[model samples]
Target: MSAAHVISILSSKKARTMTESSQAMEQWADKLEAVARRQDTQAFEALFNHFAPLIKAFALSSGLQRQGDHLPDELVQDVMLAIWRKAASYDRRKAAASTWIFTIARNQRIDTLRRLSKYQNDISADEIWDLEGDTELFGEIRQSRVQTQVRDQLKELPVDQRQVMAKVFLEDKSHQEVASEMGLPLGTVKSRVRLAMKKLKLSLEALDL
Candidate 1:
């Protein structure tokens, strides 16, 4: 095909390929990338555990709980699917994975809440993908451009700071929770998290979306 013809065909496809792939095994990463683009069942599950709570917290915080009829899980799943379907447009540079994921959750939650009063009846109990709750470790198979950037920025920080961050941030523990678990002083845990955030914020200063 002509380059222009190939480009046009790609433009019409539902899933977009990565702009840059790192290595040969990285072709495997392309599979999940395609899954994300296609929003396959597997990819959705992998993503859900990672970002579900963030969405749930966002929804509950936004007052979705007042809806007697809407299950928080339902709302979160809806938001997550929307994210999956829209994955093609994801700009990883502009937002952290959680931030982008939660933004979708937030928007979906808003949509669900919008119909709160209107949904006066019970919806079917289908097995909605628990996008926000399941914590499957779809190990970092291969780094995409975005994941690579994140890894590099993370590498720039001290090892101890990184350890604290992995616990408190990625592990979803609070400063106190991490502190108690690690047997560190509460203040020390808080300081570590604060410092971690400062480092990340600085490293990511160029992009804030």
Candidate 2:
């Protein structure tokens, strides 16, 4: 075949692929909308059949398998439940059905991690700020002074680091929870928290407290 003819064939294939993709997206959206508009179990079942395997793969890739073989199943259940309950909130214009559903899966994974971490040796705010060293000195006067100093130091941190520190320490959220809520990768959230803590530690040391 001539090069131009071959190029035309490739272009036709690409267009067909795009059209098929758009149709598939629209079909998913229609199914989800049916479930939303009415308690359509069949439509919901269709969604489940389409999304469950994909979600399972995502869960395994996200390290859920390390926790337990059953955890991925649990995550899938949670994501589907959220879809059922929150179907009415979905807007196709804002996100495709797959995008919306996977976001829920991601958040559910974070929540699962938070639940699992609770049973582990989770760090406390006092530990993060090194207040465990001097029990006597951590009394009311010293506690108040340290709190004021820490607040001041927190204000000096970069915005991203400060937000992560606030969510993880002040709000008592797990790193995974902070990551999901902030729309950041888990690693980025952890790195920000670590950087924030390091800065706080340096500031506290300079204060000799």
Candidate 3:
């Protein structure tokens, strides 16, 4: 064959390969959208089978593992559940299907971590009343204001400190436990918890004033 003809043939073959790849990707995206719009179990199962191992690897690499080999599986389940619930909200224009699913998985991991941090910190109602410093005695309205202020202040806290606070108070974890789980020094964990508490208290105290 002439060199010119051979080059043209190779170029045509490359074009066909590219086209096939593009079509395959489009079909995958369409399947994801179908699951979102119709809650199609088969479509979801296909996606889960394809992406679960990848998501699990991501979770493990990111240090989200449980002691047993269950964290990756659990994390995949959580991601899939979020995808199921939020399928209708998916917007193809804003993000590709794979990108959207990955984002959901990432957010679920963060939520799982925060949930672990908030599992069991016990505080009594009497202590709460004292913390509000007779504000409730003034009126229900005053108590509501204090509650709102506390929530707002908590939201305003830096993410690192907030995580520490959640683990220490809500999860009922000791600072050592928080340190161990987070892979930080015990003093660092204590410092974060103390700083978070101080900032929250100051914000609430200012609101009370």
TM-score of each: 0.39, 0.56, 0.50
Residue 105 accuracy (lDDT) in model 3: 68
- Model 3 lDDT per residue over 151-192, tens place: 558878999998787677544367898899999999999888
| lDDT (C-alpha) at residue 19 in model 1 | 34
Candidate 1 per-residue C-alpha lDDT over 154-199 given as tens digits, one digit per residue, 9 for 90 to 100: 7788887888877765443578888888889999887776677676
Poorest lDDT segment (10 consecutive residues) of candidate 1:
125-134
lDDT tens string, model 2, 139-158?
43443334345645777899
Q: Which candidate model has the greater lDDT, 1 or 2?
A: 2
State the C-alpha lDDT per candidate: 0.57, 0.72, 0.68
TM-score of 1: 0.39
> Best to worst by lDDT, what's the order?
2, 3, 1
TM-score, model 3 to reference: 0.50
Point out the higher-scoring one by TM-score: 1 or 2: 2
RMSD to the true structure for each prediction, in A, is 14.5, 18.0, 17.3
Off by over 4 Å in 3: 1-6, 66-68, 117-209
lDDT of 1 at 63: 50
